[model samples]
Target: MKLRQKAYALAALLYLEFSNRTRRSSLAEKVWEDSSAEQAMTNLRQTLLHTRDVESRHGFRLFEADATEIELNRDLTIDLREIGRIRAATDAADLATLIDLYRGELLAGVDGLGSEFGQWLSLERTRIENQFAIQATEAALRFGGRTGHAALHKLAERLPYSDTVCRATIELLRAEGNEAGARAAYAAFRNRLRHGLGLEPAAETAELIEQEGAAPVGAQPRTPARRSTDIQPDDTIRPSFVPRVVLLPPLQDFKQASIPRHLAPALVEDVTIGLSRLKSVSVIAPHTAWQLDPFSALDEVRSHQIDYAVESRIAPNFTGDGLSLAIRLVRAAGREIVWADKFAFSALSAQERYWDFTNGVARALADSIETAELQRERTQRDANAYSHYLAGRHNLRTFDLPKIRRGRKSLRIAREIEPEQASIESALARSYVVEWVLRAGSDRALLDKAKLHAERAVSIDPNDGTAYRELGRVALFDRDLDLSLAHMSMAADLAPNHADVLADFADTLVHNSDFNSAQEKIDAAIRLNPVPPDEYLWTLGGINFFRGRWEEALRHLSQMRNPEPAFRLMAAAAAMAGQMDLARRYRLQALKLQPDFTTSRWVSRMPQRDPADVDLYIEALRKAGFK
Candidate 1:
């Protein structure tokens, strides 16, 4: 099929899948953007020509009888069209069929299509891939030695790079007392890695193969010991002993690249950090939860012997401002969703706009974990602070001077209402930091205020890592490298697996000229929460800039829309590495964005870890055309 035709089919399929049949005009607007009716019709024709027909009128057809309207075949078997039905099906056969239909790219070699569709396609692909991987692994583990071999083999073939699938295959072989087969499978995997990617098998794989070989033929295969599920009967065990709650890692609807794979772990950590602040609740460490899979809520609850479990999923809010999170609380014994809701919040900025949706979810989960009437009290207080904070956060995303001023105004209101609330204070301090960093503000003054706010927040509740994190930001702005590092380090230690804290810490390290360490930290943060904030990419660009990898720096920095001064700095560095004209353009942009931006001001703003590194940036920016 021609590329143009395929693009049309894919577009039509996407429209039919996402939109109502009656909204053809809306679909055309979305798919074709500003293209005229004639052009859209032509594309639709080309798409129909490329699509294969399964039956008469039910194939991939595009119709536009009315100039203003467009429509697709109602009976098309597009992969996306089948996904929902397949996913909802209780029958394994239907799922397998749907899985088989998902082959290669949704629309290969199609560009000029907007990023929104492309992002959606990417997320859908990831979700399907993860689903296939998980189901395949579960099947292999459950019935590998019985009726699951053929299915397992097919899954392994499709997802050859999945360590989960490989491990499951080995487990299946070992379970059937086929040690030799398992060894052979390991050898094959090792050879495939070496030959295909020029890389050796990971240590875990090597260890597993070696351990398998040493085990006796008749001996039972050893697995890690499961946590004790003993529930003692005593007055201490109240009917609602939901005090101990384990937040299982969230599930990602991997429909966008920004959605981090490590988000599950990070989210779990975030909830853990938030819940730990409550003196009444005993939140489980992410490591202690053991079960990371969102699908295994029931199994985890029973195994971990927890009274309640909180599960969450992160998806982009169609509203275009920030992230939307869905959170649910389930009673361990009954496997019922005791509470479920969706919360939306914009990304964090230097100024306040609104409350964090994820924090709201955490707050709700906290309420659920508490016993009876206390739940109401905790919920009301947390709900009020959370709503105000989210509003402040949304305003902060704008990053303009007026927006920052407005955001600060909102934050002041939040702080007034929840004077002792750590989340509220931390959020408000963050807004001030944003103003200091992005707009015109005294770094020292902002840092001093931020320090006081953050310190007060921590004093209110030392266990709350968010407050410590705000303090770390203040330290960074103050050019106190050691203090910044110490505070961020403490935040990470408190919430070892939280993504936001890790990303922020990585940013601090990059600012301090710890390039290699920053890269590792960023990589780890990405792994913990695959979808990092745009600022994380900006931080990466800074790291690359300091390392003199201009091209790599440009790659990271370009991901951001409407370049900030720091981004312009990286762009200038990239241009300096190659084209002088490009360097001049970026440098001018940087100056325009910050008319008051000078080498002295820039140096003063930075938390100088080393006098020499400070000198280096000062010199580089001057050379790149900064005033």
Candidate 2:
């Protein structure tokens, strides 16, 4: 679809094509078929040159040609080639790759030159679709028991017209006793077929509807092991455990010898950049790490959910140009020093020297962190409830309903296993608070559920900021602005370096009509969270909206991963700015998510200290067609 020119599209189809390598003459015939032989040759030559130029500008070599033949670059990897390889391979390990590679119809709606190219595309598309059908069927049977039931259902939706895939997915879900899921899958497929292709699924698929499984649905923490044992695969969802590291600001006068103040920040920045480049470790952004002094650094690191701290201090030697630097790699959880060393280097005035020193330090630190994490993992114990709690926390960050429900279930299991885990309790309570805010028709019952767990969590551990944060969010939605601010303020005081809490507090401030304070908190949250979660965008968008920056608000909302509620918000902002057509468009988009959504139920109780802002919000909602 991105192909700009007719020639370029044809060239791509031929060069990267499966099972057909175009001869130079055939390519010329297809692209310039109407021209004379001489003219065609000239056209082909110019097209290839221009195609090569386009590829170069994009920084990738996609095609190569000899005097008589053209082919895709041998070194370059393409999904079609990989799919072919996976189809031939018998190894089950490759099935995952196969399923992922079969990402919709090959080139979807892309068209090619003249009749020859079109014919080739049609044949290839059919071939690829059949192959994917086989792969998804095989994978569904293979991995259905290993994970959730959504995988197969999603695969069925990818090629909705295929009776083969639809039958396989429906059967899998039915076999798992998920009749609702099977019926939902069938209906989704039926809808796709009717709307997208103006056809229905096979009559056999109609039979599946009576049996069930048709609905489509959408939507971490802690701990230490008690003993040395092999780590078992836990029945929880979490990212692969990788060591997260943070670099402290280098101390300039630990030895009571002075170095230039600016030099420490610069060298620390260089070291942070180098560490960040290591693929094995997640480095805390230097901006957040800089907030930590040596006294409070470890506590802050642990609160940020980082595993290791690269603590370093530089001191000038009294008599020489050389500076002495001490570095320690610490395990944040246990406060254990995993690795430590000292070195001497000349003051790096030359850029080359500075890079050489910084790169070495980074590699060494990264290597040490990796080794330490591996050592810890090798001695890890059987999976515990804490593992599930951590998994739940990770899922909660996704900010979608399916994931939220999945996470909440994990936390419930965790609490059942370890009733005393304050963190688990807090996390479960927060899930309720989040559901109350985001989900349609949220009621006081959800707040009651949140209150029980949050209070219990706070009772169990009075210092836990997460419990307070959940309480704060609940109060904010209830329009108790003063109560909400009080609780959220305490959350920040207890966990100042926590990006999640800070972002939530920022959102609360916006609802309370305190835009300036909200801006400051949101900025700090962004800096603290190097990889800020999608929820942060929604929070910042709210701030922009209340601050009378409609376009900026829309910009933020547009970047969200799930933009339903955002579209509703965008509609209001657009209408307030007198962009009625845009408002209507956004309103229609939001209605697709919740057809009966009304401003009264959604926004009437919004916490606001300013009467004018409240009136403005009401006017905008009406203007956006919200009843």
Candidate 3:
């Protein structure tokens, strides 16, 4: 029932900690850091054998280790992975299970394997503790009333030194009118802080306590406790401080009794899911939104340190036959409505409109939040990383060569500040792709760098769709059309709600000559992003060009404010349409941007599903006077 050897325990723990396959060399290096490579390999093999023996004796297979790699049995039920359940749980019983599952610190009595193992264990322990505290506090806050109070109290007892846990416990007690209980919780926390760490309760925590008058029982410190200036005022312990937003449940307008009862909640849920898929913003859970008090929403926003609030109201439109959904994006700092929009739709219409509404609201709110963040003051270095990221994204959207370079510089700084950020890595990958494409694939090194960043992004977070899309683009440039299609398809599957992912997928599909499917994908993307970006327009134009709709291609291409990247394609499309004057003009523009651009060389770099498509493109380009 127990692993007698520390090495056996370490072997099993390594497999349990990381769900992915573990290389034998990596396992050896981590467990036997002081040993020679050969000795470490011998040690790892012995450890794995011992662990296997223990598992077999218990009549269970914990892992399978081959000559080169080891992987935990996917079907084996491990209590440690239950940490994931804690974050996903919304009910009291499920929330309480976290308390049971996390009996104590991970690998409680196991010790002193190696420096590598020790460092890894130390980081894992801290991560577990922080994750447990944050998840418990969020669960307690979301499920209010007696159940929530009990959960918070248990959380506070479990992690007494965690300021976030203690604050949540106090806040819940105060909200429930338990003044004495609130004061006692605050007093105990304050005393624990002073005694354990020679620190005091944070200003915000003490302010909550002060509002309830002096502690009734504990003796106050002789010298007033000063707040620590180093930590941010709210939830600084959270790993990622991305802009937090809450989409409040839509309020019903009784004046519109004809509106469907389910429509408003459905819209909110759609928008919530859409926004959650995006890396730009972190959304408050829909359950939390449903339970939030709209009357004192500002107070809730302040309590949660939320950056933006999405409030909606459903009412009868001017025609009375359709329902009007009014959405407003409010900046939490000043409580000002920065953006607002209203969508009118009939109940009989297809649910595609529902997605349209979701996409429009989510995209606009994310952009508005980014704009607000750029103008706001950054209080910490971590905050600066986000500012640089936003600025980088803004510059990249301009589609100008100099601006794109500036964007890469900003992204590099952001990546330097936060090396583990998948979004930053993904953006860097995109910047490289843009540069590679802008230069007409003249520099293969840019594609290599893009691939590296994209690989890193996916490695950091496999669920990041943009990373996959960038990886797919790199594959396309490498002339691996099938691999490009696979990665792009995965990206779309991973982020179905992301307009950018869909647009990118459509663009890749065009190269595969799936014209109808590509058009459908791009159309859906444009639906989601009604005011489409230049990339979306270029994708649409490309699809049209391949479909032999030359005039349509030109129409979309001309709409791009900076159409330099699409100039060659525009010239080809115009020439194919027999517009000789317009084709020459566009060809001149393309040459102005890249004087060395040649049809034969450029066509060689392009990926296509059929060689005939390549021939067609070359013919059109040559006809347009592109040598």
Top lDDT hit: 3
lDDT of 3 by residue, 362-418 (tens): 555556664354234112335456556656765665456799999899889988988
Q: Pick the candidate with the highest TM-score.
A: 1
Q: Write the per-residue lDDT of candidate 2 for residues 90-189, one digit (tens) a residue.
A: 5445565566777775555665344435544543454466666666576567666643244455555565556567777777777888787677776776
**TM-scores for every candidate against the unseen true structure:** 0.51, 0.43, 0.43
What value of lDDT does candidate 3 attain over all alpha carbons? 0.70
Task: Work out candidate 3's RMSD over C-alphas.
Answer: 24.2
Q: What is the lDDT of candidate 1?
A: 0.58
Give the alpha-carbon lDDT of every model. 0.58, 0.64, 0.70
Q: Is candidate 1 or candidate 3 better by TM-score?
A: 1
Reference-based lDDT, residue 536, model 1: 68
Clashes of 3: 0
RMSD of each: 13.6, 29.6, 24.2
